[model samples]
Target: MAFNYRRIIVKIGSNVITQANGLPDLQRLEKLVDQIAAIKKSGTEVILVSSGAVASGRSLITVSDKNDSVATRQLLASIGQVKLINTYSHLFEQFSILCSQVLVTKEDFRDRLHYLNMKNCLEILLQHQVVPVINENDVVSVTELMFTDNDELAGLIASMLNAQALIILTNVNGIYNGDTKLPGSAIIKEVTAAGIDFSSFVSTGRSQFGRGGMITKSTIAQKTAKLGIAVHIANGTADNILLDVLAGNVTHTRFVPNKKASGKKKWIAHSENAATGAVQVNEGAKLVLTSTKASSLLPVGVVAILAEFKKGDIVKIIDERNKLIGLGLAEYSSDKAREWAGQKNQRPLVHYDYLYLQG
Candidate 1:
């Protein structure tokens, strides 16, 4: 494949930007900015999803007064987010690049309207030739996160903004096929199949100074690939890594996207965090929903109500076998839905306008 990416989302994790001292590493940050500047000079629109605010904040305060607690983390993030963005702004400005800081919470994309608005804001920034450096609003969002990680955010932004590629920069070389400690272990160069499982080779451990692991990056890569966007998971420390990956001269894990899925289908099927409830349907309904020219889900096909949800909530539409067929905003409450289950006639459970089948 040729490097024809026009718009790209680059995710820089905490470890990639922060040193072991829990502070922003200038050398690494400078190299990264230089690469991104080079990419911008090539006429590519770039969005950065960064994750070093809290880690940088950790070292800002005294080590003797450390709690390593969530509350303290929130406080540190409040302090460090400013510093992190300021540093990014200065570096980008040196290269004549305009940068803007945007703090987002997972709540921003909880609904269709909200998500579209967020999309519009990003579109405006890109149109005006400003690079938006986004980070999760860690201080404000406590109960629910706006993104699972920067990896997930990058995937969402790549898909949401109709980006051509997503490059996730992490500490590792890429997804390894065997024990990362062993000598013979190798990186999986490419993943092309839909629903290709990589859990067996993944570890549950998270990275230091970062919330997500390699497995999390891999999962995000797979989900974004379904939307016809290429995903690259590569080592951030490697020299000219970004340029090399674009040139296809580097050893990195690449996810080749399927070109069949539409934009709406991608927004639904890959919305792992935005969904709210579950609605189980029988065999007849499952077949119809997955078939070509799918009609609205009628009341007669619903087999069970697995969760209590209100109308307009994005619920998971599952088959009797517990296979997820699609996601749709509910038109009825859980009580009304259960009462109308298997009935001959009723309003469409989920209208065609909102229903999105799995890719």
Candidate 2:
């Protein structure tokens, strides 16, 4: 099927931007900028999620005696982000395309206020025909709060912007159904709302500068596709790959989107704080939440409360097996939930506007 989208999020992996020596390649970056300029001229909005800070830093800094520890990586990122964004700005300017830099740590999205601010900033830039280049703020991020990789960050950004598609540019063409190097290995052309398994073909090797491998990209594809955004994993190193993928001319793996969740529910579901607390429910409650048009989650449905949460906080609703069934805004604190657990005639714990049904 031909894929046509007006808004897109393109993610460039570190491997695509760095050489074996871990230095940024200006020529390659210029090529990408040119393609983005062409897409923008076509009147499509594009957001770029780029990775290369640590790799660029590795080229500039000397860690003579120190081991490759977390601190060393953070220090390199601090030095590298400036170089990365500067190079990008220069390249985009050559095409007369203005660009803006957006650095986000996981905490930025975790906090509601910061998330909204980031969204607004990107929207404003797009309004002015500026491409917003995003990267993780690795320099100041604590290990516990750091984003796992750029793939996860891209997914969050795509969902936040309500993008039509997300293109993840990597070194490989796409997911293979068998060994990638094998003679007969076939590219998985399309994936519906149902998932795909490519365990045998997934690369275990990390990129020279990035932490993510194919597994993380696949995970991101799955998450974003579930939110009704198509995801394409194509080889960034290929000639004009970004443009080809956007035009549906590239040989790539495409994950089709599921039906969309409501705007408020989508935000609540994608909230980073959703997993902080949970309410376990009986099978009947799960059905009710999934099917009923009711406004409130009745007390009779909640089987148990798993963690402490406050009113207006997002919380996960899990089944007995501990699998996530849905997400909802809590109507009461965790303490209140516990008090009313297993009791009848209590107020609804979560309202429907705050609930997101699981895919």
TM-score of each: 0.92, 0.93
By lDDT, the best candidate is: 1
Global fold similarity of model 2 (TM-score) = 0.93
Q: Report the CA-based lDDT of candidate 2 relative to the real structure.
A: 0.83
**Model 1, global lDDT:** 0.84
Off by over 4 Å in 1: 63-68, 291-296, 321-323, 332-336, 344-347
How do the residues 177-243 of candidate 1 rate in per-residue lDDT, one tens digit apiece? 8779889888999898656577887666787888888778888888788778999999997888899
Q: RMSD in angstroms, all models? A: 2.3, 2.1
Pairs of residues clashing in candidate 1:
105-146, 106-146
Q: Model 2 clash pairs?
A: none
